[model samples]
Target chain A: MTAAPTRLACFGGIYSNYLALEAALADVRRRGVDAVYCLGDLGAFGPHPDRVFPLLADHDVVCVQGNYDDSVGNELDDCQCGYVDPQDNHFAQISYDYTLAHTSAEHRAYLRQLPAEIRLEIDSRRVLLCHGSPRRTNEFVWESTASDHFLERLCREADADVVLATHTGIKWQRQLAEGRQFVNVGVLGRPENDGRRNVWYTLVEFGGDQVQVEFVPVEYDFARLAREMADEGLPAEFQETIRTGWWTTCLEILPVKERRRGAF
Target chain B: MAATLPVIDDPRVPQVELASFDQLWFQVAGTLCNLTCHHCFISCSPKNDSFGFLSLDEVQQRLAESVPLGVNEYYFTGGEPFLNPQMVEILIATLEYGPATVLTNATVLKDEWLQRLADADAASRFSLEFRVSIDGFSPETNDPIRGEGTFARALRGIVKLVEYDFLPIITAARSWPEADEARVVGEFTEMLRREGYRRPRLKILPMLHLGAEVERTHGYRPSERITAEMMKGFDRSQLICDHARIVTDRGVCVCPILIEAPDAVLGQSLAEADRPFGLSHGACYTCYQYGAICSNPSAASGGGHAARPT
Candidate 1:
């Protein structure tokens, strides 16, 4: 086995937010990270779906397929976001249609080939990277809702010492039994609905038996992104979430604790 | 009327193994209910004491036992969960271990109870979700089924829950035809918004033809029972028995829906209840159709195009 890298940067759900991707990659390079990984969802909720591909390609960011990526790549009719509410589904369909129409055939093919999970050894600790939970790609593992035992079972079933996922778009970390950990490396595609116009990624450092997980906030050109979205005639609700951190659409999937934290 | 058919003694009935103990349910209020709705599957009523209230101590014990099983979520249901005096305390205790959802009729909710629960929910890391059962958008359509004046009373309770900043999910069993689902849901949403819920969350449930519903509507046909062939390549995760067990005053039952059935009681503890259950009941067919009907939308088994990664 090769020696485990000291520092690794991971982010999830690009959501066509190429600006944030560019800024986050530059920041990762400046920090001198040994490896960078992305947890799928390269399209949706932003303008210019093609802009995100070059960023990932140039940075050599290994990615695991997300639900959106799986849907768009396979030309699925819906985003497979697992929304039950009619209104949420309506807006999701709008975004999915826009994304599917804009994403190039080349990028779609590339997404089709991406792995569902990436396994690596970080200082002898088994680190598993997935788009959502280890068991399901679209599963929502919210901090307030996911029990410690449930997370531990997921990690144990996947046979990993540390599990990293990001479907809920909110960043959280839980210390599990036997000093293991589970981290949701929040998304760079959108603000975390905390009323801040900044997105986030995670920096994980492993030294000996200890692991350090840090949520690094990335500041990008939100005004430009908003303008671009408006120019593309995307829903005002999507642009609102970009300008203000509060999620206007897709609010139904949020659990009570996470939803209560936002202004929606 | 259709001819009554004999029960099938077929050996081909599929048995679903407990995949994981993800959801643990408690029949907190037992068979006691404030309102005897026409469509109540278990026929829960104020006078129905077939099942008794589960004490806070019993619930706490089960909660402790559920930890090792890696239960994903906790649920409370009954004739009405809030009727139990210790309902708030039980939910508060449950939030310590995991998220808690209570199925309730909005007719009997107390502001003080909501206040305590809201406080507890605010303090805990987990969420406390209230699923308020309201049959219709107006009294004209709902009163005949739920009881006279229940619609207004329940609407008031929902308003109070909103006042507590609890975005309760308004659940209604579909009493209308399947084609009218869109219209019925739209009306329900509009009514809720007018009644002060700016962002209404609604879940429409398929009627379970059992208990009181058997008398109101026709009982399930013998063909409704799940067959062995039906389980082939089927996602058993959609079935509540695959991932959940209910703790009642009697003991741990197979599910919240089948607590009254003679064979539904699995065992005395969570460990003993971790066994396969025969899908013989007609209600099991309903469950098979509507996956994870008892869980919150967030915790529901994704049933559509969203594939679960093996």
Candidate 2:
């Protein structure tokens, strides 16, 4: 196994948000990070799906295959976001259709070839990176719902000292037994429904005894993106979420505590 | 639907091995309920004591046992979870362990209990969810199935839950036809909003053909049984028996739906209960048809509607 970089920048689910991706990449470059990684979901819920590919390629962002990536790459019927509600699914379908139609064939091929998971040894600490939980590609590992022991078991089963994932869109970190850690590296595609118009990424640094995890918020041209979405005929709900940082669609999949924290 | 079946080993019966102890359920109220709904799958009523209430000490014991086993979330159900005297305490204690969800009819909820529960949930890192049962959008449609005035009472309880900043998920059995789903859900959402619930969460359940429901409507036919052929390429994780085990006063049962069956009681402890369950019950068919029927829609155990790749 190759030794991973000591300082790494990680983001999850670009969701076709090239503007945010640009800003996040610039911020990480300024921070002098050794490596930058993206945990899949390269497309969905945003306009101009093709715009994100060049930025990722230029920045040398390593990728993992998200459920959306799996669907769009394979030309599947729906984005397997794991939403059971009809309204949520309806909006998800709209996003998926728009994304799949707009994504370039070459980009789709790239997504298809992306690994489902990326493993590296960071300072001899086994680190695993995936779009969702290591067990399932589409699983929603929400903070309030995922118990400590459950996460510990997942870490033990995956044989990783640190597991980084971000399918649920929200960012949370939990310390497990024996100093193991599980972190959801938030999402760059949209705001985290915290009534703030800034999306976030995570910086994981391992050199000392403790593993340092920092959530770095990226302020970008969200108004321009929303206007672009309107021009592209994306749902007003999606734009509203981008502008207000409050999720308007796909609300049912959120666990009770998470939903209660949101304006919707 | 055929009167309860005996636990006989059949070669055709497909057995589902426990995948992970993700969900730990407690039959907190047992079969005793304040109101007797016509379509109750377990036939719970005021006089029905086939099952008994689980005390706080019993629930705490199981919660402790669940930690090492890596139980993801906890669910509390029965005729009505609030019917149990220690329901509030049980939930508060459970919050220390993990996220807790309780299924209730909402007619017997007290403000004091809601206040205390809300405070406990606020302090804990886990979520405390309430799934209120209301059969219809209006009393005219709902009263016939659930007792009279229950629709109004349930609405009031929902409003109280909202006042406590709790987004209660209104779970209604699909008493109406599939065609009317959109209309019924819309009306239900509107009704709750008018009653002071701004953002209403709703979960519609397919009526299980068992217990009181079997008498009200019809039982499962022989054709409804799941065959070994049906298990081919099927996602067994969708079935509750593959991930969940319920702790009843009698013992740890296979799943919540089949507690009435003597064979449902698998063992006394979580360790002993961790075994493959035979999907022989007719209700298992409903579970097979619609996975995660008993779990909250947002729960990890709840099956997604999207078509997963085989």
Candidate 3:
């Protein structure tokens, strides 16, 4: 058992957005967090998949494997994005094929070696970090869908006082029974479909028995990323999300409340 | 033409125990619907009072009881959930506990009801999902099965839902051949886009060969029964009975699809309903083929789809 730090920076689903990752890493360093972590999904929906690896390695960001990482690392055919709609699947397939083709073999090997989950003690408060939920690597714990009691059960099953996950690309936190907490750290890959041209990361600070969770928004060179995506021959829909904050693809999986908040 | 229930007492039938109470379904409007669709699995009709409406009080009671069990989501169904006058209130109340999804025919929806639901959903942290059933893409194709003028009426209801900012999932049972799936889905998307739904969500469902559907098509064959051998290495979570239970006016049922069967009623409460169910019914075969058919797309898993999301 290693000693846990009081403050940490965490993010997930980079989606190969190296510009955002660079900005986020610099921001994390400026905040003076004791350590940094990433919740897998290091590639997809962006250009230059190889650009993200050195940023993570230089920062010593410990990572947990996401479903996308699992798929790309193993050379799987699709992204395993769990979309049911035909149009959504069509776009996802395009992104997955591009990401898989562009990802370097060395980076693929690194993704394959990443652990599915990481456990640590933050001031004696057990914190479990995983790409999605602790139970399933690809589960979407959307803020509008996950219940307090359900989160409590997940904590109990994982034997953690705090659970941090990403994968839904949205950030939310809920304090559960016995002061336990579950946090979905927003992604750094793209905007959260909120019509804002910025991505987000999460900061967790431990004080005695209290765990504080904060979502930190990061602004980067979006126009450049959009240009890169277009140059890579990615779908216009993917670049549209980077240029504009609204998500153009993968709209069906969103719950109604979350979908209502978006501009479509 | 009523559908006949099959009785199978073979011990070889696979028994699936409750994995977790993730989804709690309410047969809120009971077996009474505004339209008598030809392929309705439960044969719901305007006068089919075989199952009775569940009041807001009953739903509230179940919601309270379901909290401690760690239920993840809630669903409301019936002949048509909106037919129950308190359907909006029930959905609002459910949002307080967990995410709620309602399955409806869309013809009975009113603007006022959607307004209230939209307001409630905005305030709550949980989502309120609507699954609107429209049999086909156009009136010529859909009216004969659902009812005359039902296609146009349902489209109006869907447009209203969109106006209220509800991304209602258009659910349709696959009446056309499988080879035409792409064409049918494409047409449905085009029609919805023309009707002001810029980002239409569609779910194609397999026909459950029971109830009114038995009269239209045929019931499941005897070989469709799931044997104990079939359960080997299978992901049991794909089965609704493995993770869900439905509360009706009478009591808790095993699953939403088998409510008319006498053996489907498990108990009076969620606690008592936490038991294993035999996969012996013919409709169970449809569930076996098409996993999580009654659940919203958000919770469904496995069945000729891409892998789970990243």
Candidate 4:
């Protein structure tokens, strides 16, 4: 019997941007994708979670806890992701508080019970859904890790053909030796660092034997969101990132050695 | 085929000094800090003394050996260096070598201590600089992270330094949007000017995720880090401290930041530490891409660019 190819959406870090999420959903609907999976960190950092949550629910997106989502869901005081300098002034703090308040309790509850990992099948091909690293939700797994053994072990344990991840927002896909692939669907609220204003999302088409993931940059008018955040007196910093497609509050996100190393 | 052209790892690879100055930060009080700021790179706090104090004798012993090898200045850092009872003596001995800088939260620079340090700075032949870390200008802004009343106490410390004609360089983390940075720094500069210092050196630092910082936010995303192959065109010379060493109470170590990392210890003496490091961590990129992270001129300093001395 000829196999029916399955297509899926692998994406996360919505950061509460309704415009971007709506655009992404439209794409998913058009593609007639098979499954919708999130990398984690649904909100917290951006200004518009109220709108993004409904979309996730309507789409019945499979999601996980990003560090920000974890802190908010846990009712924790800080964003457990270790991304900010506690000593920051009200400008930054105001932003964090705003993001925290914008997060829906239902979404927080959803995130609270969310699985750190998930496994999927595409016509018999295996796939793993992990936020950052397997088992460790807040860990940062990048190309720099360059460790084959760990990924190899993960694929074996999950009995999967590919791993999908998010948190460090960027589009990347690499093939390990046999048939394993590591892909990060990227974040929707922040710019992709490629100097583009549009955020990133990914759609994967899978056949019985092969899977193809494509980076889709979605453009939207952030004027309403930016103005709304400003009106809400949310962190001006948060408002700025929504408009600029980048973040400036680089506290915990900046590695100490790298901080000292100076970035342009 | 007779002339075997050398591979890219050729002798022609240029070398640049990463940092002649070493941030041999003496976590004098260990992980014990005066304030429990959320994004502390190493996550130090008042009660968390995971690392312990190195007495005057220990510091002096390390310094004695360091000067002979052309080791430059010494820097004293801690949960609060002054928290140490013998911190004065540590400073006294440190100044005799090159110059000394003590990084303080400025939450507790008592009058008696400041008077002594100012006297020593004037007496010393080498340059002595005091760098203070403050997150923002106002209490509403700075206090949230540093605890209430810290900004008030910190300001008094800065005022005292200015009174003594000691232009202390104020450092603040870049915790706001880039568009607001200039205004924020300008306000700091203006505040410092009104407080009696003419030229205020402010440093805008990138946050390092460590210790409590990890709990506050996430650490480096797996995306950030250096690889073996990426080091090909990388200037080996820029990782300066790799060739040098830090003589601590324990022994000589690779670099300041790596003190906590395993295999951080290179050898017993400064000369013995002559070797190259793999630049395995995310922080290595800071050194490789930018020149130095520890030894910037001001707190409001700009982000790094490909700068060569004019």
Candidate 5:
């Protein structure tokens, strides 16, 4: 069995923000990691969706298929982000339409061929990399809603000791039974709902039966991204999230605990 | 003569297998409710004793059983879950296990109960969701359906819930046409905002045409049953029976919506109830059309097309 990389830099939901992606990769390079992986969602909610593809290719970041990737790849009608509120879906549709229209055919093909999940072994512990949950591509798996047993079952069913997922856009970690753990590696696409203008990525390292998980904040030129979004005719709400570090759209999917923390 | 309803044993009716034991619902207060709502699918009323409350011990037993099956969350429902004497204790105990959501009319709630629950929620790692059912935006529109004075009482309950700092998901069964959702939801949000709920979370649901609802309006047409052909290319996980089971005083049923149906009872225990359920009823058609009707917006389970926005 090929041993998993000892130190890995994992990024989630680049969302076409090439600036943040570039910043995150450079940060990862300076800190030094054995490998870099992206947890899908390379497009949506950002400007010029095609720009991030070259960065991923240049950096050799392995990726899984996120719901957005699947939709853009297959030329589907929606982002499949699973927002049930009209306003949320309306904003999601705007973002999806923009991303779909902007993504290159070659990039879409690359997204089309990406695997749903990747499995690795790290010092006798199995690690699973997935976009949302291991089972579904778009499942949110918010911090407040995922029960311990639910995550335990997810890991057990996927035959993984450590499961890393990102689709909810927020980062959280829970230690489960025995030495098992689950981590939402956060996102490089946008700031978490917290009022901070910085995106995040996770660094996971394993040594001597101990797993160290660190969330590293990646700060980029938010004003530049917001300007580009405005230039591209993206929704003001998307630009607002970039500039203000607070989520202005897609608020319906948040559970009470997570929603309570946001400025909204 | 009336038309014969479809039976479960029919081979042509599609069967939905239990995909995962993700949501476990408890008919905590059984069929007894404080007020007789015109649209109640189960015809629950204060005088009805057809079903009885599940004791806290009983709920705990089921909760214990649920853990082994890897149940994700617990939902408490009924005529009104708060009508049960032990509803507060049951919820407090459930917070220890996982996230819990209780669907209530909110009229019978006590400050003490909300206070205890508020404290319990604050301490738990999981969220305790309160799905408060209020059918219409105004009392004139709501009172005729729910009962006289219910709108005011329920509004007070919502204020109390908010006072305790709980962001309750205001669930309203769509009493108006689907096209009016935006206006109605806007009005509802404004009402909640004026009543001191700064940020309101709302979920609009389709009415299940059963029990007293049939008398209120016409029941489901015979043509509304789920045929096997409809199962093709359709996501079965959209149906609650495919992923959830309800624990009642009698036994474990397939889904919360079908608890009153004779065929709804799958088995005596969660383990035994882990069988495929036949979608033979007209209510199954509603479930088929509107997926995840019983779940919170946070718990949507699929990755395909976007759902119809509420």
Candidate 6:
């Protein structure tokens, strides 16, 4: 007997927006996506890591460790984002120094237990699920990075039908050399480079000769999250950035111009 | 009638930046976030300890190792960079060798921290910039994803930056459509102006799929891999990680993003990462696509765009 071709919804970076998560599941049902590949960072920068992680863990998601996940899983003192700064405010420094006093040993153990990368065969193609790059769980891949760098990484470090990544919180999709593909599922927990407070996610469908990656958006209540952060005693600035998408911290690596571009 | 197949694939389409910073990034902060949002890329709650922090000594060692090679920049990111215990010390250390930037959710802005950052920036020959992430204009617009009271708090924080005489660029993710960009910015400006912030600058970023975002939406496609043919005649220079290397406590990683990859570890030095590398991930494709078509075409970004702005 023959089997039906598989359909996949390759998403990543669900930073804890339950409303958006609900919408994504609805999308999967509507699209009849057979499988869902969660690239990693199952929790970070949002209010309900516990709520979200349990839900995702229950699903048949192909999960990997995101840079943030590494921090959470390990109970590392810092996020290890490597954000270069001239002065190093206490917030980031504190984040780096923080320990897992509140979380259970089980959750910390599980995060460490998560794989850096996951590989699956889809449409006769080897799909690699990684938080950053395949070899590194915390690497951040962005559009500004070079091609030969990527080509060399793909050709030399590892090979796959497509490399799915998260972090940088952006939605992007591109085709690479040698019939390979790259998809940035974007951040469902956050906005996709716009000023409005909506979220983004992607849906991918594979056909006999064609493949497609779709970016999906959702709406949720932000006040609840802010209140949660407040209730949790999170930093006021960090809580506020969630609402505004603006960083209170100084990014030493950003272009001088990327500094202070948005007023609100 | 002229036939326009909609250019299913735009031959002359402007490209998108998809390459990973491929460098190994540090988990400067684990799940311990300054703020908790609904749609955090990695649902980082106050208690979520996922990644660990590198010691100042480790960072110093990494810096020394990275200087020999062309690797020149460093970035700090996390639940809250300021939240890290040794953040100030870490920045002081990183400035010795390379310029640095810190990516933060920007809800809390302390006058002392900004003053210190400014002083250090003034003191250092290397550059320092801040990329603040504020999702929307009003509480109604932004609070849904970030959390309750976030809009007011974040705006107040931004206002505080203005008090520090800073016009911090507001980083907003593009949750809205292509059409709403200007109004968004305009509204943002009006709000900031009312808050005493003038000369508003904005950077709208697309969302990334990972962590909490995965639950927020469906993921990618089977066909989204980067093919060998995708690189034909493409300018690989736009991908900065090719020429750049990141120094971490563990060693000199290829780029700041992929610290876990052994190959990315690149010996104990940046000089080692200088060796040629193959574009290995799907993020590379994004680098090519947008690096081809997407530019900060916005008038606010009057200057030519940086390969990666943040």
lDDT of each: 0.87, 0.89, 0.87, 0.62, 0.88, 0.57
**Which runs in model 1 stand beyond 4 Å of their true positions?**
A1-3, B1-8, B303-306
**How far does residue B191 in candidate 6 sit from its true spot (Å)?**
23
Best by lDDT: 2
TM-score of each: 0.95, 0.98, 0.95, 0.48, 0.97, 0.46
Docking class of 3: acceptable
Off by over 4 Å in 6: A1-5, A86-102, A148-152, A245-264, B1-310
**Model 4, span B135-169: residue lDDT tens:** 77778778877788988888888888767655666
Number of the candidate with higher lDDT, 2 or 4: 2
Candidate 5's residue-wise lDDT over B53-127, tens digit each?
A: 999999999999988798998999998888888999999999989989999998988988988998898899888
Residue A211 of model 3: what lDDT? 83
Candidate 6 steric clashes: 219
Instruction: Give the lDDT of residue B78 in candidate 5.
Output: 90
Query: What's the lDDT for residue B66 in model 6?
Result: 44
DockQ of 4: 0.01
Off by over 4 Å in 2: B6-8, B300-310
* Clash count (model 4, backbone only): 32
Encode model 1's per-residue lDDT on A105-223: one tens digit a residue. Answer: 99999988778888887667888999878877888888888889888988898989899999888999999999789999999999999999999999999886678999999999999
Candidate 5 positional error at B49, Å: 1.7
Could you tell me how far off, in angstroms, the CA of residue A18 lies in candidate 5 after the best superposition? Answer: 1.3
Compared with the true structure, the alpha-carbon lDDT of candidate 1 equals: 0.87
Model 2 / residue B118 / CA error / Å: 1.0
What interface-residue Cα RMSD does candidate 4 give after superposition?
18.0
Q: Please give, for residues A100-174, the per-residue lDDT of candidate 5 as tens digits.
A: 999889988998888888889988899999988887878889888888888999899888999999999999999
| Model 3 CA RMSD to the hidden true structure, in angstroms | 2.3
- Per-residue lDDT tens digits for candidate 2, residues B1-310, read 2245555478779999888789999999999999999988888899998889999999999999998898989999998899899999999999998999999988998989998998999999998899998888889989999898998899888898999998999898888999999998998888778888889999988988888887789988878888899998788888999889999989999998999886788899999999988888788999899888888777643233222222
Please list the residue runs of candidate 3 whose C-alpha ends up more than 4 Å from where it truly belongs after superposition.
B1-3, B302-310
